[model samples]
Target chain A: MKQFQYVRPTEAGLAINALLKDSGAKFVAGGTNLLDLMKRGIEAPERLVDINRLPLKEITKNDQGFNIGALTLNSSLAEHKDIRKDLPLLSQALLAGASAQLRNMATVGGNLLQRTRCPYFYDTSMPCNKRLPGSGCGALKGFNRMHAIFGASEHCIAVNPSDMNVALSALDAIVQLSGPKGKRNIPIQDFHRLPGDRPELDSVIGKNELITGISIPTSALKHVHYLKIRDRSSYAFALVSVAAALDLEGTTIRWASLAMGGVAHKPWRLTEVETFLAGQQISAGLFQEAGTLAMRGAKAYEHNEFKLKLAPLSIGHALSIASGLVKA
Target chain B: MAKEKTSKASRRNFLKQSTLITVAAMAPPVALKAAEEQWDERLASAIENVPLNIEVNGSVHQAKIDPRVTLLDFLREHLQLTGTKKGCDYGQCGACTVHVDGQRINSCLSLAVMNDGRKVTTIEGLADGAELHPMQAAFIKHDGLQCGYCTPGQIMSAVACIREGHADSDEEIREFMSGNICRCGAYPNIVAAIREVKGGSKV
Candidate 1:
């Protein structure tokens, strides 16, 4: 790792100012991904502004909904009583990611800004547009079993490797950011961007901005499920994961929110399937239809054709589990 | 325009004379060679070190540390607490697991400067002076280790797993302890040890 200066700022304003003054400065909160990237020489920041001292580790509730501070550890958030009771999907998703040790060190903001687990991006020798702009994407033709199947441009095919983001997308979370200008709230769906021509930019956050907290409206959806399918039962990135939450009225689906991970540059929201499931009776045939509708525009690469089949099956399985038709 | 031109010419002349004077001052060949040989090392050591006041294993330590030094290295190298191992050096492996503020975390991913004024408990701190911790005793009783390379991390993570209430069942223990990889296939024994400890068996 390259030697760098470290600053611990107690105030959010000071952290923002430090980042604004130094273009090469990065905010280090729970340096799980950043340090790993630094060790690999994929990220070499000249300065790291430590935001752990900032007053942003609260998990509070207000009129809007539950407010989770950006610095809250993933382990704490997953085990929090209110979170487990109110938003079990988020807890399930958080526990399904990385491992017990990583969840303890990872922060909410860090998880939101984590880089892809693409092998090409990690290898400095390989050409990855996400790692270096204008560099050809090696995953497009190389071993791409984990590449994106949705919202992928020719320049990059890497998927966002965050399970928490998928649950946040389904729950309609709001990201609170503090920047040079002021505070702003960005909806979670718009927070992460697709890899168009600009594969380098991960989030819509500005260079000098720091994430303060995230808010999720108290969900009325009683049945929620996060199903992550990976090579191992744990300690691995998802091959295809589904976050399904449904509002049901007896045997009928009142509303639904669905998102797929490991298949898109961002969490792939199944809006069409969501719409199709609304006001419909819950049945095996209806779930099959919804799953087929969810895979309408999914395109697969050479090694990831299994995802095309696995994605729908996982979605169906998740829906089945959420609807209480099948036990998880 | 005329004043600017004269000023630019004088600045150039001053720069040339200063370069000549600097070279003349370094005319001693031996002195220049000595300075050149030690310049890189000197400058590297001169890089600012952050003041860290960390409490490790119930002992307070005050030291100046390089901001890039990880908590794992700070424990193993600086403090001579080699009981904590560094398997992958990345967060992928749990060999560098340690307790920060009573919560288990990957020390390899944590910077020494980040944990200033915080308490860290490594594998070295697990046992009492002459008595082994319950987890350690259980590991020995169950023969949980083969090569013993990943024992420190596994023990730390297992202690945390039980404390975090994720050791209620065999599957939960396995899932929660998935971060620590024992390549020697001591998993079944490790799980048995964890279960025995979780069951509150006296060693």
Candidate 2:
């Protein structure tokens, strides 16, 4: 690992100020991702602002919903009573990700802010737009199997690899952030951005911003499912995954939100599919049609043509599971 | 969760006197403690060498280390407690799995400073003198290891699995133990060992 300076502030305000004011520092919450990147030489922060000492480790009950402090470990979130009871999908997604040991230490904030796992992005030898602007994305034509198909820009095609964020997207979660100025809330759906012009700016979060908490509002989605299709059942990134939550009256769908992972710059929200599935009877054919609509605008490269097929099937299966038409 | 956090004063009692070695040990006896202390006083103040007063099993230790150092590294390197392995430095792997404050966590992922004044039960601390932890004993009895690199991680994760009520059934054990990967393909024996231990009592 590259040698660097480290700071551990005792208070949350001091930590945020240190993070925002320091031009050469990056916040180290759980250090699961940051430390890994640092060791791999992917992220070289001249000064590591260790925010672990900050009081960002609380899991509390708020009037709006469960106000999970940013530094709250993933295990705490998964096992939280309110989350398990109300937002089981989030819990399930968290459980499906990484391992028990990681979940216990990986914080909710770091999980959301974790970088993409694209082969090119990870391998320093390869060219990746996400890693270096104007360097070109090697995944576009080389080993593009895992690259994004929808809402992708020519600059980058690396897919968002967060299963928790996928569920959070379907649940319409909100992020609370503190910075040099003050604090602001950003909706989960709007938190991440497409690699439109600058693939570097993965999220709307400013460099100075430190995630404080995440609020997940209550919703009447009768069913929720996080369907991950990967090579292995354990510790594997998704080949194509879908998180769908639905509200059903009798057999017809009243409300729905679908987010596709391993196939987009962000956890993709299928508004077109949601609009099509509304007021429609829940059926395999209808779900298939909605899935088709969801992946309609997908653009496949030389290697990721399978996603054109896998994306729709996965989404359809997730919608079926979320609508109570299939088993988990 | 209030019950989860033990008070600092209560935790201090857990550390043994032996761990409280004098700060005199930090310097050469010949060199004056005041010597060169003025040169980097600012740098030293920037990073305080926090004392980790923790109890591992029945024994307590006070580790004076860089607060940024992780508990996993502190145990493996400074303390020379290597029973807990470091597989994927990232929390993704359970190689450095251990019970901190009575809960399982990826030691490599947590800063040692964060665990100050907490009870830490590592694999080395799990056994009673010469006796192995039930999970460790069961692994040996069932031949649940091959290369043996991942055994420590698997065993630690298994203990947490049973404790968390995730080892209720064969399928549950398989799903729950998915967190700990055994590339040696001794999963069947590992499952059998965990089942044997859990079925014994207090499952």
Report the lDDT tens digits of candidate 2 across residue range B40-87: 343443444566787776678886666557788988987789999988
Candidate 1: the clashing residue pairs are: none
- Give candidate 1 misplaced runs (Cα > 4 Å): B1-37
How well is each residue in A98-191 modelled by candidate 2, as lDDT tens digits? 8776777788999888888888988889888888777898888898888889888888988888889998898889999988778899999899
lDDT of 1 by residue, A64-104 (tens): 67999999999999999989998999999999999899999
User: How does candidate 2 fare on TM-score?
Assistant: 0.87
**Share of real contacts kept by model 2?**
0.53
Model 1 Cα displacement at A208 (Å)? 0.8
Displacement of the residue B117 alpha carbon in candidate 2, Å: 2.9
lDDT of each: 0.90, 0.80
| Shift of residue A31 alpha carbon in model 2, Å | 1.2
Which 10-residue window of candidate 2 chain B scores lowest in summed lDDT?
B1-10
Best by DockQ: 1
Give the range where candidate 1 chain B is weakest over 10 consecutive residues by summed lDDT: B1-10
